[model samples]
Target: MEILSTPQGDFELSRFPIRSKETLRAWDAADEYLIKVLHEEQLLTSDSNVLILNDSFGALSCSFSATRPVVVSDSFIAYQGLLENLQRNNIDQNNIEFRDSLREYGEVDQPYNLVLLKITKSLAQLEDQLHRIRPHIDKNTRIIASGMVKGIHNSTLQLFESIIGTTTTSLARKKARLIFSQFNPELTPPQNSYPKTYTLESTDYKILNHANVFSRERLDIGTRFLIENLPVSDHYQDIVDLGCGNGIVGLMAASANPAATINFVDESYMAVASAKENFTKAFPDREANFYATDCLKGILPSSCDLILNNPPFHQQNAIGDFIAVQMFKESFIALKPGGELWVIGNRHLGYHVKLKRLFGNCITVASNKKFVILKAIKN
Candidate 1:
């Protein structure tokens, strides 16, 4: 945990699922830059109705807690992080309202005075959010968004201008930049065409993906490789699709093992929702469990007969193997004795070494030029 000093207050913040010797801070320079600017300009008042988007770790929400801002995000982990940080800072979380990104802003009773967006890695998610929030903002609404220099591109600015209004940017500060967008009531923003559906190749099932879902446009190559090589057996009764994006892996597993009860899990609410919808559409008669949680956090110990994982290599903009490492460790704990954990990842991620270290043995199940599939048995 680190101290994040802002004009509102000094908050000791840490990322969700806090780890020992954690090097990453919960807040970033972009978060600090936005808060500094907001404070200096006196843009907020006690009665101001504020909405904060994609606050990865509650930096903006906690900073402006006094205003009772409505915090919105699609990530379950990020939601947990915000709660954890708010508790750590001894702030009354009851003052703040938390909303899932899937919820429509049309339900809001009043127009927001200010909207602070911490630009996310998914441009689709950003675009969807802009469309959703468009109905709730007027010309007087102040929309300030912040992101790292590398994250803000021409496409990013284009979305703001096209969807919101006339958008501009501030000069870079500490490798972070702020975006200013004025609400243009004249513009009729395009309707959100998200939750897209596509036919799964070689199968009759169609997959539906929310805007923020990974590989929303099509089956990503890595997942496609995993789908082609899924291990299906009658002995695997309780199978889990860890990091189940759109629940395709689990759906395939279910197709093969009709008797097996599939559990679809992912941290993204939108991902889980898409998975549930896709699964229900594919197998209306079948029953499965879905969870939007940190990998296997609430799962029973040694209860799963099989676990399929395509671990994410990064959290938001910061790319690293920390998330994959955690998923591997959790998979080991969640698997029953003699059960198997199957993983497919890029060849360079070195997942075999991690699996061998955790499960004491690892074997290559399949491999292509770009992706490799590894299997580890919990003995």
Candidate 2:
């Protein structure tokens, strides 16, 4: 991995989970663009309290460690990566305060006076983040957002205008763009408009979704397909829902196995949170564990008797099978001998081959025109 060399400092940063053997640097051009803006504007001082949002792999926080920035993100994996990056850079652990976007941050005497935002793919989430920090901002506060040129658009600028105030963009530099938005106290602060809830008519149950949770509006087609074909058995006592968005898979599994404990794991804090809410609503007297984690990293090996998954083939705008492959690998580690790992994924992703590679066997439980449900058993 290339050492991130910016005006702030030169530090070797690697993304969390090291998805592949060839490590990719955590920082990007947008990170550089924002770092440059902060330097050119001379926004730093010993007392320059800062809030960094949507920071992927902690580039902003690592660069602005001297400011004791508050780091906010929806991805627990990103937060963990940030901590790892800070440790690598020899920054004090206390220099950065990590906050998950879904949780509340209590009152602090010295609120953030500066904000560095990395535009996320989810515009709704971006709006929510801006809304979340609005109340703490003052006239003197400076907010600058950065993203790749391809990500910024008219709607992006409009969101800034509506949430913050008048906004202006900088010329594209190194394929990245920046927006400077003024803090307008007149902009009516938003109510907690996140963790949106909707009803699943099939089960007569309500599902809650936070801003960054995938398929937040409703049950995604793949998961819906999986739910319709969920494997049920009385033999499996502990079930794990890998990448459990809103815990629907686990909810379905729990409904199938009344005596089993369901474990819901996902990288998104909001997803885990929404899953917990939905689980409680779905099964009032059930036992469960909701973990916002990176591919079952801390889960006890071979502890789960069965694992259910709707593996994500992409993260943000980048599409690939790496995430799914890692999930399968993790599921293999977490499942007990003779236990089953059930998953529904796109037909084109060829998950069966990967499962066969890892578990030595893969069986198609079911298949539709666009998706396939596969079950792999641990020997």
Candidate 3:
């Protein structure tokens, strides 16, 4: 854990699923800048009902835990981090409220006094958030957003202006910038176009994707490659789609293996919801399990006969193979003896090495110039 020194107070913080020899700090320059500005400018009042959006860890929420802020995020891992940090800091769990990003905020009783937004990689998600929070703010509400300078661009600023109101930015400090958007009471944002739908190629299946889901606009090349090479068979009675984005991979596997039951799992609440919807729409009579979890943490040991995965190489903004490593380890434990784990990834990721290390053997199933499909058996 690292100490985040802020004007309010210094708090110990760490990223979710704390790793050994972790090099990344939980809070970033933008988090520090936002905290500094809040205290220096006297933006936060004791009675302020603050709403924090997209706090990667618990940095913002933990720093302002005394305010009893309402925190909104779509990531299960992020939520876990927030809870862990709050408990580690001895903060009262009841002091804060948590909400998922997919739902509307009609149940909120009063307008927010302040809204803190941490810009994300998904522009669609940011747009959807602005539309959702628009009704909860008024002309008096203070809207402040922060991100690394590289992450904020003309398109990002334009999104703010089009959705919230007149938007402005601050001088960069430590490569981090802050955005100030005045809530315009008269402006009506465009209708939310999230949960996009598209038909899978050469199939009648309709795939539904939420705003934050990866490759929501279309089938990502890696996933498309994996789908074309699925090892569908009746012998694999139980199957799992690890990191199942919209359930297309699992849906296709189920289509070919009619007698097998498929399980769809992803960390994103929105992704799981989309997958659940898409799977149900495709097979109304078939039964399946959907989980929004941290990489099969609660799944039964040696329960799955086959696991299909297109492991993500990054977690949030930090890009690495740590997520894929974790998924492989989990797949190893969840697979029964003689069970198989199939993965498709870019050739540069070197997933075969990790799969070999965990499963003791790995074989190439198919390959193209950019992507490779590999299979490992738990023997």
Candidate 4:
């Protein structure tokens, strides 16, 4: 990634996942456009107190490190990227503060003079952020949001107006646009609509979901297929739920295999938190491990007898199999010899082919019109 030339200072940026020679740049034109708007509006200063929301990486934070900005984001990888990128440039670590969006840290002790916003893929998440930050904004606070023109939509602007009041837009530059919103005294603070729960007809308990988890409202079709066809065996002891969203897979695994210990891992703090809540609600006395991680990257190899996965094909706005392929590779590396890796995916994704390539053998456990449940055994 190129060094970002901002009014505060030029700083380097990197993507969260840390892929080498990656074609995608960490920060996009929206980031640069936001900086330009800030400079034009004379908002950047040493005395300015800044709160940066949803900075994909550390671009905005690093650029404004002098003002000691507070950075709040949802992805654990985004938090890691902030630290790594700050270290990459040898910037003073004391200049920035970090917080996860899953936590109740939106209410600030002191009001911020300037807020830089980068709209994320989840409008639910954006609404939640706006709802939380409503009390913190005043007449003097400047809230400016920027994103790719493709990302900004009519509803996006409508959200700004509904929450922050009297929102407006800027001319497109380099395929990016800015939204300027001012505080409205009349609009009521938005209510929190997330952490919703829905019951599963197949199960006795309901699953909880935070705003941004995949298919938060209900069971996804892929996982739904996996559940109806989940293999039952007494041979497994240690089990893992890779990319466990609300931990339905691991919970079901636990119920089926009473003697086994189950581990649930996901990158989102909210997902892990939701999984933990659901696990406790479903089986309070049952022992389980919930981890927030980037796949099974740091998990000890050959430590599990079975791994169940419904890996995501997308990371933010970009859709591809990079993450799912990486998850498959990680599962292969982490499973014990002769251990089973079970997966549920869309048939068109060709996950069976990739699993066969990595695990040496793949079996179609079940299938439907749109999804296929496949299993692979470690060689």
Give per-residue CA lDDT, model 3, range 1-379, as digits (tens): 7899988788899998988998899989999999999999999988998999999999999989888999999999999999999999999989889998887653565889899999998889998899898889888899999999989999999889989999999999999999999998788777888879999999998889999998999999989999899997778999999999888999999998999999999999999999999999989999999998999888899999999999987897878999999999999999999999999999998999999998999999999999999999999
Identify the runs in model 4 with alpha carbons over 4 angstroms from their true place: 106-109
Q: Give candidate 1's whole-model lDDT.
A: 0.91
Model 2 reaches what TM-score against the true structure? 0.96
- Looking at candidate 3, the ten consecutive residues that score lowest on lDDT are 101-110
Local distance difference test, each candidate = 0.91, 0.85, 0.92, 0.85
The Cα error of candidate 4 at residue 339, in Å, is 1.3
Give the clashing pairs for model 1: none
* lDDT (Cα, tens digit) per residue for candidate 4, span 1-379: 6677777777777787777767787788999999887878788787987889888778888887888988888787787888889998888888988877766544555777888889988888888888766777788889989999998999998888888899999999999999999998788755678888899766678888888777888888888878777767888888999998888888888888888889999988888888899999988888899888889967899988999999887886657888999988988889999889998888898999899988878999888899888999998
What's the CA RMSD for each of the models?
Answer: 1.2, 1.6, 1.1, 1.6
| Clashes by residue pair, model 4 | none
Per-residue C-alpha lDDT of model 2 across residues 1-379, encoded as one tens digit per residue: 5688878779888887665564356777999988987888788888987888888888889889988877888888788888888899899979988888865542445456788899988887987887887776778888899999999999999888888898999999999999999988787645646768889866688888988888988879898899999888888899999999888888988988888999999999988988999999888887799898988888999999998888887664456788888888888888899999998988988889999999999999999999999999999
Model 1, residue 156: C-alpha shift (Å): 1.0
- Work out the TM-score per prediction: 0.97, 0.96, 0.98, 0.95
Worst 10 residues of 1 by lDDT: 101-110
In model 2, the runs with Cα more than 4 Å from the true position are: 19-23, 105-110, 189-192, 316-318
